[model samples]
Target: MTNTHIKTLTAAILFVPLLAFAAAPGSTDSIETRHGRVDVIADADATHLLVAGKKIATLGVGSASLFRITSAAEREYIIVQGSRPGLHCHYSYRLLALSDSGPKVSKEFGECLDLGGAGMSGAEPVVHLNSRVDPEAGVETYQWQGDDVNLVFESPTLCGATGFVAQKNAAPVRAPLASRVKGSGRLQFLSAPDAGCAMPGVFVVPGDKVTATLASAAFVYASYTNPKSGRKVQGWVPRERLSDL
Candidate 1:
């Protein structure tokens, strides 16, 4: 080969290896905490959870494309979601704890359902699991005490209704039936108390009487008896929408 041809061939041989390394699997990432940093690596076979360069766990991808990492308070967790063929799904979560000895895996929770969402809630940062139990979805709360995570509250998952378990309040006194203020226009009824939950629409007309069954900080649960059909309609209505009859 000529001198120029030999130089060109030599350059190609050196460049190919660098390209392969960039595309290689088993890449690693890190997230920093108050004390040190946590490490994660993804390989062809499974994703590895590491801390201080020591592998703590190997999480297979299973039916998911990747894993999701999230943090709450001072705690960190890894989440993986996957679906099966028969409308079944799984949500897996593993909590990571950092100590002086090393990084340790605290607890692993695997929930089987259609799979919805999980997050921290309430004043003490309890874990809340929101799943589609029936046609409706509600929250099941768990409190972490010491090394034990105990189920605390389970909300009813019924369409157009709300109930709670383990609530320590006296029976809710239904407010005397009240009429929609004459000039209040149309009251806005929601499927849930939160504004973005769902707006099913106002089920009652102006001046219709509605009894408040439950009251919260921002809204009231009201039930109305239709004058014509006698069917009962109940939903969340803004507390500002009704006046004493």
Candidate 2:
């Protein structure tokens, strides 16, 4: 055999193993061969990044193919990494495994429909707010679980306020509505008086943080009311106590 042929064959044998070894530690092709068939496949129909069949990160890819295996907290993740040398820019993908599990555990307003049989008045999933206000303490709220909660609290009072579960990155993670909403919408805010801030209740669905704009535009309206502020008013309720809201 020609020297060139021998050199090429040697390079091929060495390179192939190195590539598969980097896929995942203790998951080398050689190791897998010692066990059984290696299942690394790229499902083109899938919405994720995959290298040699294992899913990697998948967020965005612009004709540039780059993916890696990143480790985190004893977990192995197929990570996607890409950069344009000519364009001098980089990109990444947020690839994920499609679950064979049924449509995620969904929650509906029907579950939280009656606020667990709580006497919440006004339109279902909606309450009417006249020019008046509720003098009693505790604010109005609705929810099934943290995951599927669609809370909206607002007051027209100069002390007018608004609150609800604010959503962060709407990554569709496989989880029950309750578990998914943890650490989400934990914060609260109040609208400037001039903004006529209307906190509308939301019709939330599990795994639906996407297509959801927690921005100024996504503000739902619970109802409309007017709390004469500049003018005289009843004694103030302590901030700690929501008696005035």
Top model number, TM-score: 1
Error in Å for residue 171 of model 2: 18
Off by over 4 Å in 1: 1-24, 30-38, 51-56, 60-115, 123-185, 196-202, 213-217, 227-230, 240-245
lDDT of 1 by residue, 57-111 (tens): 7764333322223333455333333222244544444445454545555454545
Off by over 4 Å in 2: 1-81, 92-94, 101-226, 229-245
TM-score of 1: 0.46
| Whole-model lDDT values for every prediction | 0.45, 0.22
Candidate 1 residue 140 Cα shift, in angstroms, is 9.7
* Residues 1-245, model 2: lDDT tens digits: 11111011110001011122222212222112211222322233222333334433332322222222222222222212222224423332221112222111112222111111121111112211211122333233332232233445533232232222212211222332111111323212223111222223322222212111122222211211123332211111111212111
